[model samples]
Target: MSKRKGEISREKILSSAEYLFAANGYHGTTVSQIVREAGLTQAAFYLYFKSKEEILDEIFLNFERQLDQFVETGQQLNQHNFSEVEKHLTQTYIGLFQLFGANKNVIKIVFNEGGQGEKLRRRIVNQIHTNMTQNQSLGILKPEINTEVFAELLVASIERIAIRYGIDEDYSPAYLGHSLAGILFQGVLTKNT
Candidate 1:
């Protein structure tokens, strides 16, 4: 089905805002610039978004919704799947990498903008920690491990790798995911060393 005019206009505004926010810092970008880039009038922009900050909030909301969907669908790590843990982890990471890759612009904005990035990072870390704690209860993760620290480490590592490889398209999502899974599960040290 075709999108309604309002829907199209709103999407244009969002797309333009995301691009501008990524290219120029969020503080540097203006409502007028976003409207101009979107090929819509200020009135149209306002119809969709109340203010520049509101647009950014909408963008973040969109990203968060997508992330939530990914988490819900990609979370399959459990005690029942212990034998296939590596495979499940690799697939989960691949999905995450792809999600990040697709939203690279939003990721750039999130990391480079301000305290909002920190807020988003903290929320993500918390989600990961919650998941880790659940897995620990299930005996999938070692009880000795600190879920909070591991969650923070995983988020930081994934964010860095996504920016480095996923954004640039330097490596496939599968490659990055597989590599990350290997690194996390097996460690960087060689067995013989």
Candidate 2:
């Protein structure tokens, strides 16, 4: 099915706004710049969005929706066995890397911009913490380990790594997934040390 004219125009405006917001920062971008980049007039933009802040809100809403979908589909840490746990973790990380890679621009805007970014980060951390707590209950993760702290660490690490190698294409999603899993599973220090 083809998209309607209005739908196309709305998407154009969104795309243009996202790009500009990422490139110029949310406050730096203007509604005029968005409309100009979208190749639409001010009236056309208003038809889709009320103001510059509204566009940013829309962008964050879209991203949050996607994140919710990813979380829903993202499997919890496996409790069956060590190998299964490792495999599931690797898959989860791969999915996250891909998701973040696809939305690098939005991620940039979220991380660089304040306000909404903190809320988003907290949401992600909470999800991770819940998973960690579940795994801890299942004896997959050590009970002594603080799930809250671990979850925060995981979210921070993943965000930074995704922004770096994930966005820049320095590493493949599969490789990053496996590497992160290995790093998390096995401490960085050598056994001999």
Candidate 3:
């Protein structure tokens, strides 16, 4: 096959797998089903991916690379001012949700059915913990709070909110980000002061 044809077939296979994985769950999806969905033969599917897991991995690898860039950008931020911190965090949340929103089906597959989801979840939590620790050290964040626990809560809350609101609907990402930042900074209860 020509290189162009090969690339087209590869993309078709990936798109088919993504749809099926999202609909049927990963273990329930098979190579034959993917090939049938893609309107390609088993031979053509094999030409692109050695196995279903490879295609899943490829999808997640792209997400992982993007997420890494997000985390790295957050880490490079050195804003000590409270307003700047809130702005950076709001941008971070918006960007993170936008990443998932852009790839909703892939996010569903990985988070619901793939082992890599758990790994990615843990990595994100750890990254949050590390970033919070650094912020406290730099005096950008309060040193009194236990950052490890807070990191876990933050990661879990973001995932829950994204899955609930950001994935399928036209809800505002900016509102979600700003609301989360408010809760993070001020807690749920109104401050008397």
Candidate 4:
């Protein structure tokens, strides 16, 4: 196969692996199954990722990169208006939901068992911390609260919501995402003074 064709096969493998991992737990998913679902040989699968665990690592890394980009862009959008912040956050939340929507395997494998899923977990944790700090600075999240603690709590909330949505195929990610955003916005915008 051509290099370009190989690249396509790699993506297919990743896509298929993600779905499998989502449906079955990571340990439950196997290399042979991923190759079968991707319509590729075990050899082809190796061309992209070394093992099933590696595939999970790649998926988490991809999500980490994309999510960081989303938050960075969303942070800029938040600078002008609190309303924009809410909108930006709602949109980001839905985007993440959709990304994870590709397969519940990812949520199950990474977000839950995902505690040790990747080397990128630290990056993910740090990014969330940075985002919370930015929100606190913007006067949405409480400035006095410890950003680290808040980041952990915020991630837990997001993980729980993602798992709930991931399992319920009928659930509307945007609606649920928006609902969470509503609570968060209120938490931020309600005046204590």
Error of 1 at 32 (Å): 1.0
- Per residue, candidate 1 scores C-alpha lDDT tens digits across 1-193 of 9999999999999999999999998999999999899999999998978788888888888888887754543245764467887787778889989988888899899878777788888988888888888888888888999999998899899989988889989999999999999999989998799
Clashing pairs in 4: 21-105, 22-104, 22-105, 110-114
The candidate 3 region of ten consecutive residues with least summed lDDT is: 73-82
Model 1: which residue pairs collide?
none
Candidate 3 structure quality by residue, lDDT tens digits, 1-193: 4579889899999999999999999999999999999999999998878899999999888888888876665475574365677788788888888887888888888679646899888888788789878877887777898988987898888888888998976577877888888888767875664
TM-score of each: 0.93, 0.92, 0.92, 0.73
Model 1 reaches what TM-score against the true structure?
0.93
Rank order by TM-score, top first?
A: 1, 2, 3, 4
Stretches of model 2 off by over 4 angstroms after superposition: 69-75, 78-82
* Model 3, residue 34: C-alpha shift (Å): 0.7
What TM value does model 3 have? 0.92
| Model 4 alpha-carbon drift over 4 Å, by segment | 1-4, 118-122, 134-140, 187-193
Error of 1 at 179 (Å): 0.5
User: Model 1: how far is 174 from its true place, Å?
Assistant: 0.6
lDDT of each: 0.86, 0.84, 0.84, 0.73
Task: Quote the lDDT for 74 in model 4.
Answer: 36
What residue runs in model 1 are displaced by over 4 Å at the alpha carbon? 72-75
**Which run of 10 residues does model 4 get worst, by summed lDDT?**
112-121
Q: Please report how far candidate 3 places residue 172 from its true position, in Å.
A: 1.8
Model 2, range 79-169, lDDT digits (tens) per residue?
3466776777678789888887898889889888889999888998888778778777877778899989998998888888988899889
- Candidate 2 positional error at 147, Å: 0.9
Best-fitting candidate, measured by TM-score?
1
Top-down lDDT ranking: 1, 2, 3, 4
